[model samples]
Target: MARLYDYFLGGKDNFAADRAAAEKILEVAPELPAAARANRAFLGRAVRHLARNGITQFLDLGTGLPAPGNVHEVAQEVDPGARVVYVDHDPVVLVHARALLEGQGGTGVVHGDLREPEAILRDPGVLEAIDFGRPLGVLLGAVMHHIADSERPGEIVAALREAMAPGSFLVMSHGSSEARPAAVERCTEVYRSAGLPLTPRDRDEIGALFEGFELVDPGLVWLPQWRPDLSDMIDFAAAGPQASLGLCGVGVKR
Candidate 1:
């Protein structure tokens, strides 16, 4: 799934199988590439916003294949002393992250599953990079949707939220079915066929994932609606709501 996502983002880390799966999905929803770009842009904006606000540590859950404008890059650009712990269950993602994403002094990679927040929270590398007593950013970009309701995704989020300190930030983006149901269904079929179950939630359900935290400006809107850049502004308006099949927001634990 990570490799398939890498293909969607035009990265070269994907295999032919990943490409095949992504191509099938693209045939169903042609706007996916644009949506992936919008989601990536949101990640950068969210990380920059948190960094600028003095949050020096970040925990990037389900960190996919290494790419430009990654969390460490964006955060370290703002403050070289900023620390980041990239966690992903996929061995391929961890290998790529450790080789290409981890930097000296402050950045590290840990192989962990998002379903088990307790193990991730107690990871030695993660603990070394982040201080639970201080404010930090927890980035769950395009990850929670992969977890089904049977997995109790809400409880998983709540556990992570419980581990966070006051003033900590939670930045998330999830696949949403609100904009175009038919398109999302078709895309979901493609993923399911590939053995990757996708459970895109509606606006209210996605919004509920932020329980116990206060939303930031432009709360839980379309991905492009959250502090869009110039290109995002122009492209999203031209593509309409379909260009934003994903919902994104940031919240602070207060």
Candidate 2:
């Protein structure tokens, strides 16, 4: 799945299988690459926002294949001392992360699943890099939708939220069907046929994941609308409604 996402963003780290799946999705929705780019840009903005707001530690769950403007690269750019722990269940992502992301000071990669937040929280590498008592950022960019509703994604998010400090931030982006239901359903079916089902939620359902946290400015807006810079503004204006297919927001644990 991570490789498929990397392929969507025009990264060269993906294999032929990932490219095949991505091509199938593109057949359904050609705007997917634009949406993927918007989501990646949102991640850069969110991490920069958190780092500027005094978040020195980051717990990036479901960390995908290392691409340009990654969490550590964005956060560390803001503050050189920023600590980051990249978590992912996929061995391929972990291997690539360790080769490219680790060996740098205050950064480490852990093999873990987002569904099991407890184990992730308890991992030695996570504990070494992140201080739970201090304010940190938890990034869940374009990940939760892969988890089925039957798996209780809200509970998974709540568990992570409970572990965060009062001022910690939750930076998340999710795929939604509120604007274009039929198109999104076709996209979902494409993923399902590839053995990776997606559950694109409505705005309310996506907002529910942040139940215990207070939203920052522009609460739960589309990916391009959240604290966009000049470049993002141009992209958003050019992409139009396709940019809204993925919604993103940042919330503080109050």
Candidate 3:
């Protein structure tokens, strides 16, 4: 399988097959790179919010790639002692993360499927890096949709919700069909052809995942609208159909 990092940043780790698939997606939604950067911004802001709110433990699932502004680095900036457990099914990421975090006291990577929460939560690396009794940030950025409805996205989210302590939060950003149906539809078709299911939920369906949690301010807004970095972000936000095509939100466990 091709690693996400290969496709997300134009890296060479991708196979020719993956590159061909990515090209088809870009043909449909040309602003994908921008949307990715916007989603990364949401991850950073949400992590900062959690760290600022005294959450020092994080479980970043489906962490696509070991990019520069990684979740551990972002959280540790707020609290140097913060701990993070990064999970991904990609063997490349698994290998890379292990090497990158070598000798790093508070961080580690594990190979696991998000569908197996029990195993994931019980992994030695995860248990050692995080304390569930304390507030934890469960990050599902740009990944939940990959889990089909038959696999039960709602149930998976609810399980994560139950696992976290009160005051813990769920930070998420998902591709949607709201503002750019054509672009989203095109990309959806492309992914389906490549044997990947892309379910772009509507706002109401997206809200359903937070059924029992209290949504933070500016609830379930678009990518750039969710606590953007600056005024220029709004302008950049307005340019892409994908900006309005994705839903982002943070929900605190009550």
Candidate 4:
């Protein structure tokens, strides 16, 4: 799944199998590459927003293969001293993240699963870089759709929120089945065939994950509509239905 995402972002780190899978999925939804780029843009915007609002610590859950505009890169742009920890269960992602983040002050990488918030919350790597006592940003960018209902993704988010301080923020963007159900269905099947499940949830289902967190301005909306800069608006201005396929928002813990 990580490698496939890398391919979508035009990175060279993907394998032929991943390319094949991505191509197959694209056959069903050719506008997906644009969506991927838009999602990354949303992530950058969210990180910057959190940083500008005095969020000094960040826990980037399910951090995928290293790419441009990383959490630390975006956050530090606002505050040079901002601390960030990248977490992912994949060994390859961990190795790459460590290699890239090495010697970079105020940053750490941990090999952890998003499904197990308890382990991540207690992980020494996370604890070292993130102070749970203070407000922080939890970034769940385009990763929650992989967790099926059976896995109780809402509970996973609730656990993270429980650990956050009052002013902490949860910045996330998730795939939605509402925009293009047929395209999403086809893509979900492709991911499942690759042993990675995709379960795009509805607005209410995604909003439920932020039970204790109050959504900031704009609330839960399509990716392009959430505080879009001029470029973001221009990019999706002429795009197809895929532009609305993702739901994103930033919420603060009450």
Q: lDDT: which candidate is best?
A: 1
Give each model's whole-structure lDDT.
Answer: 0.91, 0.90, 0.82, 0.90
Task: Report each candidate's C-alpha RMSD, comma-separated, in the order given.
Answer: 1.0, 1.1, 1.9, 1.1
Task: Please write out the lDDT profile of model 2 over residues 90-154, one tens digit for every residue.
Answer: 99999999999656998999999898999999999999889999999999999999999999999
Task: Please give the lDDT score at residue 22 for candidate 4.
Answer: 95
TM-score of each candidate structure, all chains considered together: 0.97, 0.97, 0.93, 0.97
Q: Give lDDT for model 2.
A: 0.90
Over 196-230, each residue of candidate 4 has an lDDT whose tens digit, in order, gives 88999988999998888899999998887888888
- Higher TM-score: candidate 1 or 2? 1
Off by over 4 Å in 4: 240-244
Q: Comparing 1 and 3 by lDDT, which wins? A: 1
Residue-level error in angstroms, candidate 1, position 157? 0.6
